[model samples]
Target: MEPNNEKSIGVQLTWPIKQSSRVPTPATPQAEDQKIEQGSSKKRKTSDIWNHFTKIKDGATTKAICLNCSATLSAQSNAGTNHLWRHYHRCKSEPRQSVLVPRNSQSLPELIRPPKFNQEAMQECLVEMIVAHQYPFSMVEHRSFREFISALQPKFKMIDQATLQTECMNLYKKRKAVISKQFDDHPSKIALTLEHWSSLDTSSFLKISAHYINPQWKLISRTIAFRLLPPPVDANVIVECITDVLEDWKLLNKCGSITAESSNSNDLAVNKICEMLKERQLLKSTDDYFHVRCAAGAMKEIVQEAFKTTQEAISKLRRIVHLVTATEASKASLQEVAGNCGLPSNKLPSRDILSRWDSTYSMISDALNFQLAFEYLQATQPEYLDCPTALEWLQLKTLKEALEVFHESVSSLSKTDLPSANRSYLNMKKIERHLSKPEHYENNHSINIICPMANAFQKYWARLREFSEIASVLDPRLKLQYLQFSLVKQHGVLVAGEKLTISKNRLICPTIPQLRV
Candidate 1:
């Protein structure tokens, strides 16, 4: 009987299930299979239901929580997630109350929305307008510009002229800082070209441009200073200004040379700069390598002076070109004459610029190429008043040939990208040899023209050889041979040997082994 009571107790325990807290249980296999089948059936259509609602488990029920309002909703299998779509639409159309949280529960912080005006985009546009185009700062306050900005971005605030000026100055400072850092880090010596320019308003400005060889062996030029100069731009003022700029860039010791137009003030400025360098111990008292006159400018002055001797012949040639190209009728006549002379029909005589000697040289060269056409025109047309005479033509030919040498030298030395210093002495020597030709001296007209040019060239030649002999010696193509030959020509062989020995002792012997004779 007692065993029977135990069985009854077991039956009673089985009948009364133990009460436990409800937790979400995993779905049964069959339910999962049904869900998979339903999902597969709906896979043909893409779903965006996740954008507005998040899936969440509540005990045994699968629910979707609205992202906008935090409203909890049960998902129905028959309707799929359509109920959540409707709830989202309703919440968007009609603003819902913020979800209240329990006092002890934690909630996420609210998101902060961006302002309607995009300040950064507007500022960038402002900078581009002012800096890139060099637009005046007052242009920012222009009514049309303001309207344009408003049309582009209605809520963006427009900046004033004062504000734009400040921005420009700040931008300049930032750029200057970057350039200063580059100058400080450059590995090669910095060559500078200094010039004083007067504006139309009579305001003077000192321009300093930097030239250096980059790591890739390419020459680079940049304008480092274009500052307004105060009154009395004397040698001392020029020296002070240049020194301040060089010191500002920390380039005093790194300076290779300072080139300026040939002027007494510039010469004095060079002397002062050399003194300053010596005072700073950056250059020795005997170092004269840091000063160089502008080669192009020197050549221009020499050519201009030499051309003055042949003004009569050059004037006749210039008149001939002007007459031929005076009118369309004259041009047509010249063309017909050219065709008959077996010359190029379309080739017209070039006009020369009075200030540019190179242009004059080009005019002479071109007229010589069309000599037959000009001669034909002169023979047939008696009314051609400025026709060049035979002697004038001969003069033109000799002048063209002689000036060709000068033109080629100027062109080669004027190039900014090439190393012209090493070739300076060699070029001068070549020109000297060209002028010393017997034909140039035999003809009276040729001698009259060549003597003065030779004299002017010699003056500049001596100056160049003095400064550039060492540079020539340094060149791989023209080593000590060029220097010795130049010295032997200028001085005797005994003096040449003594000068070479001195040069070797001062320049090469200290840094390199002595060369064998």
Candidate 2:
């Protein structure tokens, strides 16, 4: 019964269905605008184009900015996002701009694209490092080196020794092929320097290096072959090894000269090579002039022979070095003494190896530099009694001065940048002039040193290679004048003239073929 009134009221409310009878409540324009703005904002948040832009209020106006181009556009709800979308498409069509900023800048952030990691490129670099430094393959297994690499790039996987070795061999083969192609394409003949030496382990190795001027007229020296030289390293075996290398590098026909030590086996090998060149019609005339004697080896021989004369004094200096450097305390004492004597404490003595005259030169130079310190050590330290006497120190100074010339000359001739052959005569002449200085023979002590050096120089440098002589003359800077001057310094003016005449005749007759300039 109660519901019947409620129903009657609801029926009355329905009867007044204000479609036409009642004025409809007026809609608020502000509320409608707000609704529209909210709907548009929702639409913008959902649209994919809004991701490239950041929305912001510029005073009362809403704006949309492009992240890449930093462009601003209207973003009001009523402005319709269609323009914003159009601007985004157009801005993306052009390349993204890069803006440089000053050191203390507060500007648009820089957009930097980081380099992508390339595992293969990194591995190749590691393999190159191994090859370049002559690192053993097992270096990959070294804990510190591996840790260093891992710290450098955690993404780079470490290769095992076996894999590293495989990669290195592959690289070697690839580079060898490229070099072989270069040699094949080279227009000029290739001269070779052959070095055969035995290691401390008694294992002999032969290193064959090729020298030639490129098309650009630049001198290049590259080792073509380094391999084991098996037993019976005689003339035939040496020739066979060299032949194999030449053939392997496709340089057999292009072979111009072979330089080796002045030994019986090497001499015979040169003779055999000369005969072979003649047989192949590779020689321009009949002579064993294709062989160039190793000037460095000759220089070493002279120093070694000269070293015998000063062995007693050298032993004394060696003892001094041993006394000074025997222990840490001795070394400190020497340094203290050096510092007190107004000398550099770092200037310490160098040990001399019996077989290496270069080491001998270094030892003499260093010991001579520390002479005052050595005297102080002998005076203060009772245990340090091996200091060279004043006269002995003077003698060592003289010896160092004399050996310094040979040392410098040898170093100059040992350079591999250009052909050392061209410089052989000049260096030899330098040694001759230094030794035959008339002032050197004045004092008995000087005579004792100079006589042995001159004798050793004569014994080793007695016969200058014809090719070396010719090469010196070929130099534009020196030409015949330098050669004539050098020859006159050694063999007097008349003999020098005769030698020049012989050299000219030999060149005219063309005794050697494919001469490397």
Candidate 3:
């Protein structure tokens, strides 16, 4: 150690050493050139850090000292040829220096580096997006959503059609996010986030703008929240744009530019993107995200079910009907209360008392209407079923299991938890006794008998027609009635025969008397 004076020092290094010095061996022309190139890449040839900031050429007589042993060496004669020979000769007599270590670029921080996001990681993420987000792998090339991100982070070696889809999807999602966050932040503000934020391409803008044109009110905002919003929604901006497009349909007719073939591959994707954006209330009016022409062909359903225009009446009705039927056929959800902890559904007055059954009934009824409508339209017009009795039995089993779970919950609770412990205890005892009795006496199977199972097909079809016509105004996309006639042929007639087809113009009310083919 050196004295801790003004120039305090430890193990020291200097430019030149007084004692013997050794140099590297000279190389052939090819090797020499490579050395020169390597030397040039470093600021100081003997530096530990690797850097290619500015390289010194092979012919240049660059000189530097080994920072380790303080030995000076020159590129020419003294370093390798003459000096190396001296070192080789002296090495047999004297000990060699042991200060050299491997060099790395990390030693210096100013070097140009690769991006932060991993290329391989980005590629894997994109692949996952295709598999997980219901997008096709081919979309990764075409959509800007994927394309730009990919360009920023090239996941694969060769980007194909996915590039286009990536671009398209990325742009839409970004735009939607921007709009969604903007509107969600200032929910009551009329100034909406523009669907085509001047930055979007005009060709793709058509698709992006479709939702703006034919907006789903529920998705845009909860009807209550939407109503609270202030006027104009950038009234000056949207009203002006809307006026411009409505006045000249050509301005918005760019939808024609997107050919059917182009849409086929991407329709599901587009619809989903639009739906997600709208559901989150990301888009504002005058955006025309879906470009849906007003359904002026709405039926009388608009009056009875939906508040929308009469033209959409028929379509909305079909949607409501399907909604009902879905609940009925959702075999997973239908439950039973029989043999709960020690309580029997049949023996207990619970069904007759019906405390919570109304909610369930309403739910089932609504679900049944929607569900059966979807089935009826599918069946009479297309092909459809009452699930087999075995399925019904399975559903019953599930109901039984649910009851058992409930009983377990009740039994698990302490007696102090009950309002009347003695009464509850007796009730539990009675329930256990009743459930233990034979199944036939309690008439558990009689439930099916009580239910109207005779005209399942006829009733299912009739319910569909009713709901489709009535709910058409509520959801115009449910033009199941229109397509229904394609199956149930002949006007104002109802029959359960095979291959039923209603005429296109048929509009029979479900409440009306049945008509035979």
Q: Quick one: best TM-score, which candidate?
A: 2
Q: Write the per-residue lDDT of candidate 2 for residues 1-517, one digit (tens) a residue.
A: 0112312221121111112344222123333334444753454223444556679998999998876578888888777555655564456432422222233333324564334589999999999988898988888888998899999899989999889879889988989998888888887778888787678988888888888888887887889888787886778888888878877877867887777878898889877877887788876555545777788888877766656767677888898787777889888878887888998877688788766789889989887778788777788777657666777777777788888887898777556467456788778778888888888878877777778778877766656657667877777888889878877977999999999899888777654445764
**Which portions of model 2 show Cα errors greater than 4 Å?**
1-122, 136-159, 197-202, 231-237, 280-285, 338-346, 375-382, 386-394, 414-416, 485-496
Clashes of each: 0, 0, 81
Error of 1 at 270 (Å): 1.9
Top lDDT: which candidate number?
2
Ranking by TM-score: 2, 1, 3
Ranking by lDDT: 2, 1, 3
Q: Candidate 3 lDDT (Cα, whole model)? A: 0.32
State every prediction's TM-score relative to the real structure.
0.63, 0.72, 0.20
Model 1, CA-based lDDT: 0.72
Once fitted onto the true fold, the runs of candidate 1 whose alpha carbons sit more than 4 angstroms away are 1-171, 186-189, 195-206, 213-220, 227-244, 247-256, 276-282, 323-330, 375-383, 485-499, 505-517
- lDDT at 69 for candidate 2? 76
True-vs-predicted CA distance for residue 486, candidate 1, Å: 5.9
Winner on lDDT between 1 and 2 is: 2
lDDT of 3 by residue, 78-185 (tens): 344333323332332222333322244344355543335565555556555665677765664556665566576464454566464675577555555665443344
Please give the CA lDDT of all the candidate structures.
Answer: 0.72, 0.74, 0.32
